[model samples]
Target: MNGIRAFGATPSDLALDPFDEGTSSYSKAKDTSPIARLQERIDRGETKLSHDAQFGYLLSLMEELGVSTHSQLLVFSKTSLQRERITPKTPRALYFNDDVYLGFIPGAPFIEVSGMDSKLGGVFYSIDQGKTGRPRFVRTDQCLECHTSTKTLGVPGPLVRSFITDADGVVDMASGTSLVNHRTPLSERWGGWYVTGTHGAQTHRGNLSGREAFALHEKEPNHLGNQMDLRRFFDVSRYPAATSDIVALMTLEHQAHMQNFLTRLNQDSTSALRQFGHLNMKK
Candidate 1:
């Protein structure tokens, strides 16, 4: 049996052997992005990171990558594949720019990252907690298991989802899944996210959850606004910023879709190139 079903096999078992250094664009591509190139520098003891109480590296990386704090969006629901660290009180904050999305979960072992590559589409990395010198950013293959699925257009990419969650932040998967994009109706968006902007009389599934199946109404007003304080949920000061602006959430939705499109296009072009090369070899 391959690594997928092998009992004691680790997640990297398959990705390490034949494909790790050969076929995987993530491992082969050199001139990709700043984050992609950092791995080699880290291996060469060239990159040094300073520590912070609540992940100072995340902020420093954002600054280095030109990601703005104004791009903050918080998801309080346990919608993450890494559901253990996510909760209503300790929500996960997502920050992004044109080419990258950074996921920071307080008290978690690693900070998640997904970068858009011109050729590889999406490349995932995790900066783990290393008590020694600088913390190392390790390239991970596990993210592709979910990120490269049908939801991401059959290529490694990003996605945004909303879920019906309980008070403890556990998602009600039995209630089914809802994926949101720019074209999705406003009322149907942000089911598990915390919106912090004025939408006037607009209502969404955000900022509300219960044990029972509660129906969402169209006319019901969403009281969550810019003045709402998230400090009540958790110590907001632990982060670089506090507010999870609604405008940021909207932008995230749009970016996720566009990233998927770019990823699919890249995959197609890569396959075409390989096919042309094989054809030429026959002559």
Candidate 2:
């Protein structure tokens, strides 16, 4: 797993394992990510993870990850590993803390997680909800397909996108999309997400469903904006939270880019310092 994690899909990608001896080895180093630490505790018999009848490891995982249930954001776009399971009727729920992010779909077998390492940019894993007695987080690189691209500033990092989504929860890629962040305009954010709040007359692309509704948005911007309830679109009772807080969504947008920039800084500085030291040693 360590060796596989060291190498990325493309040659131009940085060797996360620390190619030169001078730099710290990210894969081989003391992995201090939240999930990794929790795994260590489990291995040492210090603690155990629990499961639930309905939410599976969701409740337990959030406790272990130290994220608030209040931080949940609901995204309905077909933009995840379980695309078939996600629709406007069943939007995927996302929760994040400063360093960790947990993604869940109701009744799904596993909970997707992305966490930050003090050194390694982002680590991806999934906890099997079915494993009752001894659930373990299994690391996977499948997330790198989208996470390590230009959107993440060429490093393994967070991804937040807003785009036009039709009724079936399909994102219209050709219509253009914004990789959301603090710089994102109010009008362009939360296209595929369910934002439940009253933002006064400040219009956004949230809560509007179907092509017709979107067409209406082009004419009347706030027609579907400032939605305080989501029961009409889907059974809000089915999700962890009845409402997706606009403040939480806004915070997520800012932090996503911040995490990417922080990761890029960590990578670049480490490499540069290592090379400088290497050159000095030869002198």
Candidate with best lDDT:
2
TM-score of each: 0.79, 0.87
**Which residue pairs overlap in candidate 1's backbone?**
none
lDDT of 2 by residue, 1-283 (tens): 1212222333235343332233544445555788888899889998877777778888878887799989999999888887888889989999999999999989777889988886777888888867567788888878777877667766677898887888988988875455777888888888889998889888888877688998898898888788888898898777677888999999988998888777666666666665575876888
Residue 197, candidate 1: Cα error in Å is 0.5
lDDT of 1 by residue, 163-213 (tens): 778877887766534667787778777767777767777666676555442
Q: Counting only residues 3 or more apart in sequence or on different chains, how many pairs clash (N, Cα, C under 3 Å) in candidate 2?
A: 0
The C-alpha stretches of model 1 lying farther than 4 A from their native spots are 1-31, 40-47, 212-219, 223-227, 270-283
> Largest TM-score belongs to which candidate?
2
lDDT of 1: 0.68
